[model samples]
Target: MRKIYITLMLVVGFSAVGIAQEINWLTLEEAVKLQKKNPKKIMMDMYTNWCGPCKMLDKNTFQNKDVADYVNKYFYAVKFNAEGNDVVNFNGKTYTNPNYNPAKANNRNSGHELARYFSVRSYPTIIYLAEDGSLLAPVIGYQTPQQLELYLKLFKNNDHAAFKTQQDFQAYAQAFKPEFKN
Candidate 1:
């Protein structure tokens, strides 16, 4: 009877842990539409199915509880497939993957038109956008949770706008303290 009680408690504990680790991901259009009522920055995760680092970014950083909770609170998260065939509309323009080959759906394919529009050159690029949907910057490559916190807080708090020079940005970086845990 005691073993059954302990097993039930373990299940409840694991279920609660799972609930806190999810970032509410939305489509680009959905996030933009929602911004009208509730203005929040957008953090777009641009990835491809074939990219190894993209998968790592998901399993390691995005899944981290601190990253998920902070993103859910301050930004709209977007998961966009850089090479997938999806028709996306943004900034009064419609974009599609005209060169998408279904045969290469799970392999290397041409870049989507939206990915090209944003000038995303590599996989696992986290593109930060303003609350009104304007582009801020692209953080390229895989970053751990603590490494990503710098950009997240800077953009969320509008701290990046204070930089008038490279040295200013360097100074900000030199004094920056990351709050996210590894």
Candidate 2:
């Protein structure tokens, strides 16, 4: 009986440790608010329910300890559903897709005005915004943990504005290495 009790205590202790290490995800409002106080850029993972790559990003890249640590440190991380009931307030107005028909299930939304505002043409678009609520850039598609790190650093350091062309970005990326470990 003592051996069994010890085993149970060990299991409970390890479970608590694992839960404590989990990433703390912030809501859109909370993230925006934090950005205002902390002076960090916003990195929003704009995802749709039907997006496969979005799920992969959540499971793979975002799950990596390095990626999580970097994002938690430098960004006001936000996960926004491209088709959801949440009303977003930006630039003195509220935006929502009241016409969203989730029943169709063919990867269609009621047409979020915010998505249109950002010109988001695809699923899983990662939108980066400056600390002052200015548009930075929206990158669409899947990116590995390492690849995502480059953009995180790029926008965090205001390098996006310096590199006006893809060639310039490529050159910079080639020469870049993370100054601090995640």
Give the winner by TM-score: 1
Segments in model 1 whose C-alpha atoms lie over 4 Å from true places: 1-20
State the local distance difference test value for candidate 1: 0.93
| Whole-model lDDT per candidate | 0.93, 0.80
Q: What would the per-residue lDDT of candidate 1 be over residues 109-172, giving only the tens digit for each residue?
A: 9999999999999998999999878899999999999889988998999999999998987898
Candidate 2, residues 1-182, lDDT tens digits: the string is 99999999999997876532234677667877877777888888888887899989888778777788888888888888777667888867788887877684456566577877888878889999888878899999988877888899889778878877889988998998754332
Q: How close is candidate 2 to the true structure, as a TM-score?
A: 0.82
Q: How well does candidate 1 match the true structure in TM-score terms?
A: 0.91
Which sections of candidate 2 miss by over 4 Å? Answer: 1-22, 102-107, 178-182
- If scored against the real structure, what TM-score would every candidate get? 0.91, 0.82
Clashing pairs in 1: none
